[model samples]
Target chain A: MAASNIDPAIFEQLQAKIDEEGRIKDELKDIIQQLEKQGRVTQSILSRIHNTPTGQLGPAVFQPCERSILTQIHLVKVLSDIASKHPFYKWNNLWTREMQNLIFCLQLRHWLAHQELETIEQVGNELGVPINVKDRDIFHLTIEEYLLALTNTIDELTRLAPNAVTLGDFSRPLQISKFIKDIHAGFQLLNLKNDTLRRRSDGIKYAVKKVEDVVYDLSLRGLLPKQRSSDDTPAEAKGGAGAPASDMDSDVFLEG
Target chain B: MQMAGMKRSRDGPKPQGRADWDSPYIPMFENFRAELDEHHDRREKIIKASRDITASSKKIIFALQRVRNLGEKIPPPLIKSKEYSQHTSTIHERFVSVAPDLKGINAYRYQRQISPGIQEFMEAVLFRHYLETQSILSPSESAKLISENVLLTEDDYVLGLFDMTGELMRYAITQMATNGELPASRTGGRGNILTGLQDLRTKLEALDVSGSYGLSKNAEQKMSTTRTSVEKVENAVYSMTVRGKERPKGWNPGMDTSRPVGEVEG
Candidate 1:
């Protein structure tokens, strides 16, 4: 037999590397699965907002939600410890979704309480992780991931505005409308490529409109707590959710 | 759950009120827009560089395909040819330009974007390595040859080796047709290009990449093509052996033997 040019050791080394990476992924996945469970718990608790009165939300929603979020944060720390030893992006896909979910939960909770967007730094500080890390390879939250969380918050808040009205909190829709519209406006300023962020950000306009509809419904019935100096003129219904990009500008709402 | 598989749908339209310009989140999102825009710009640069690298690597392989012998240095004249130099430079330039974008934490971030170019470059590198050394190039050596800035994954190394087998099949068939023999080591070694290929086929087949996530899908895809390439060489060699006495000199062995034999023989 002719001498083999391939060294058997080479394939062995590669197998070893593959096995090692699989082990790391398995470990991370174990923790991520735990994280996913906690995320669901948090979401289930937060989803109570649709029916629960806003005053009761502190004990019924935020408290339990925060506890679940903290548990998720602990799991993230465990994941971060194990993952930091390897290339960040190499195994990042394994946990990016979970991270996005966890951060979205944080953003949602913060918005429900504070009525403003959660800063990435605040998220990093709360989660005990770095945000937008660029200097060296280590575990950190990415801007895209946080932005994804913001988009999630926008979607959640849109749902909340309509529900808040149903719960007899008629003024809540105005705050939500302004918040989402502002968020949508912020998204418009971005030079987004065709990616998840772009797609999620694209939904922001719809969210802006959804909250506007709630506000408009309230104003039409004179349920608005206070009328604005300018006429309470609502822009056309986003007209259609599928309205192209150009259709968004005309969907604008004027403060009553 | 809200973020999972967030698809952009045309939900029913809501009202667009005049946008609140003085958004409290503007400064924060502006920072995001700047950072995201920079990231996208960097990604675009890397992607552009990657495509250029792929193109240059393919051209290099085209130049390398002209070589008539193996297990020795590529002819200096061919290596120094202007066309070859241009392609080599282009590959280097493309790789160097995107090198920073792929550094440290960002290495694996742009991995998907840059992988095709790396794989194509690996194919060219492996082909050249085999043409000169008559052996498979190891990942470390490949890493050294590529650039210090780029990380060469084992998947790229193995996939490139698989494609290099196709180049070998072509090389063997062309050589056997022209010279009536397989190119083997002239230094009293038992190894010939066909034996080396068969060895690679067996070696690669034996590699346990099933556990690997990225490699499992891509390696499985390449395995069948690799198997066919090795088989083509085997068939060429078999035809040459069995028909050695009857076939006219310089006749090409192809899938259709009857029609082109005389044309090739003359």
Candidate 2:
């Protein structure tokens, strides 16, 4: 309104800011690639169990998993600084690819370490990044990015469902079903407007159905454990269970 | 949530040598790591290429600005010169070289990251073309030169055009301020930049951009920005004609036409 003036000082400040962002953005690319590498390494823990005897995975697998988790936590700290500082805005793209990659790492590690999905607030706390930093905090991943990562993790879990059955872990199918449903409910609570987010959120139902079908198939074959069916196991209860139940096969009733 | 059970397994005995669990996943892990490494390298190359495109495109915009003070008619030799072709071709070549990389990465996945460079390139090239030719560069025309056989989405084209309007507004204002008046139309009456701005506004306003998800809202916001830019140019032109009448002929508003003589010390 005031004669379209371009102040030289303000322009120089903007150039400096862009330069800083460029440096950080390049650094984030490297960090995201590392996070993905660590995620794949952590994922090997699940795959290793598939090749070995169901009850014989011993404590060795924990070594790599722990290393991967530690590296990811470090990366998430760096990612949080960038995300909370330079998040989506007028000059910048709001939803960042780097944040999505970081979210994937955070979710993958939590799922492997705790066997449970991590809530956004829980993740924020773990990374020392606060979600309630008012508007445009670039250091924190937005709820939408978290939901996208959750959808990707569900896809990863769906891939693992068959391996669980092969390992004679029928209870895992039920656990996955419950886990995915809880995540689906979390997504339903958010008011999504981005077309991609809406479409991906719609996909949660399919994942829920896929996991349910696995449970249904196991149940129809009478492979399910004789647990208290009248009472539903809360998701957090099973997720927090220490160690894979090596005696899970004993719980299954085999029919001749 | 058995805390004791968790602790026990976490601190369990280490496996001895020749443990076979790692064998099954070792190759798979190596393959995944290799793929990630390749992707990282490819992205770095793309970023470099996009930066090259931005720098060259800015030079092209600077070249276009060189013609502003010359006159309404851009020299025919300059329009067809090797220099112009080289700048435009550099963009085409850069994009073409990165076509495979962009395909593998999926452009939309990194759209927000790479979009500033792409949009800036668009603004520069499109502004240059508009200067040479009085018409706005259509999406297809821009795509042909810069998209490198890979079609840029309509949304990206529209977004690029949104910024181009700002460039046009600035060019018009600078021309009027430094040259004493806007460039005359072909019939030698109204300014050509004014007509170009009006035409661009009308064309952008008539489009049905509602079908694009997430873009419609952005389109509304950009429309307001484009409107403001147009008004600024119009205001500058208004002041030049109505307010500069009292000044002598050939008096540029921004330049020092009549410097005050310093007093000589005896």
User: Model 2: residues >4 Å from true position, as ranges?
Assistant: A1-256, B1-24, B69-73, B76-86, B103-114, B189-191, B206-208, B249-266
Report the error of model 1 at residue A33, Å. Answer: 1.0
Point out where model 1 deviates above 4 Å.
A227-256, B1-20, B188-190, B255-264
Candidate 1 chain B, run of 10 with poorest lDDT: B3-12
| Ten contiguous residues minimizing lDDT sum, candidate 2 chain A | A1-10
Q: Is model 2 an incorrect, acceptable, medium or high docking prediction?
A: incorrect
Q: CA lDDT of B185 in candidate 1?
A: 67
Candidate 1: tens digits of C-alpha lDDT, residues A164-201? 77776665676677677667767878899988888888
- Local distance difference test scores for all models: 0.78, 0.58
TM-score: model 2 vs. ground truth: 0.47
Q: lDDT per residue, candidate 1, B21-98, as tens digits?
A: 366677887898889888888888888988998899999998998898778899999999999999999988888778
Error of 2 at B4 (Å): 16
lDDT of 1 at B81: 99
Question: C-alpha displacement of A198 in model 2, angstroms?
Answer: 23
